[model samples]
Target: MLDVCVITGEDGPHTALVISAGGVVSDAVAPPGTPHLRPETITLLSALLIGDWAVADASPDGARIEARGIVAAYAQFHLERSIRSLGHIDRTE
Candidate 1:
């Protein structure tokens, strides 16, 4: 199963969303912080995905938590997202 994490962080009025696919995908909806691309998010995401944190109960809409788990790897490729989205993404506005 492809567990996907829709990480949406906000810096003041600006917001950035990063969707990561891993095991036990989770969503952390807390007050967003400054917009910056760091490995911090990937590390947190890995912990959530591997630990099987409360993703299943937390998401129920188009979002979901898969039971099969995934080979959680730390991937922080802003360029990839940008290219894939056709320059539709950025860490900052």
Candidate 2:
């Protein structure tokens, strides 16, 4: 799992920065029609697909605690909601 920071413009546009557990970072484009998904989800999923992070959850509804506990915690704290819906996707496919 990875840590993610979503950066949004004041008027429009959104981007994501995903930070791997090893400290590598990658930027990603946010999904176009998934408002239920958080920027954190977009960032992490993008990183996983791009091979930025060494781990993969393979699910976007809710990542396993064993696989993405940190991500879950981070999302809950930062995004102020559960990232279940976002956790169960594979955009790269």
lDDT of 1 at 63: 29
RMSD of 2: 13.3
Per-residue lDDT over 1-93 for candidate 2, one digit per residue giving the tens place of the 0 to 100 score: 223333322222233222222222333444333223355454555566587654454444443332354445556666666777766766444
For model 1, residues 55-89, the per-residue Cα lDDT tens digits are 43444322221211111112334234322442353
Please report, in order, the local distance difference test score of every candidate based on alpha carbons. Answer: 0.31, 0.43
TM-score of 1: 0.20
Q: Candidate 1: lDDT over CA atoms?
A: 0.31
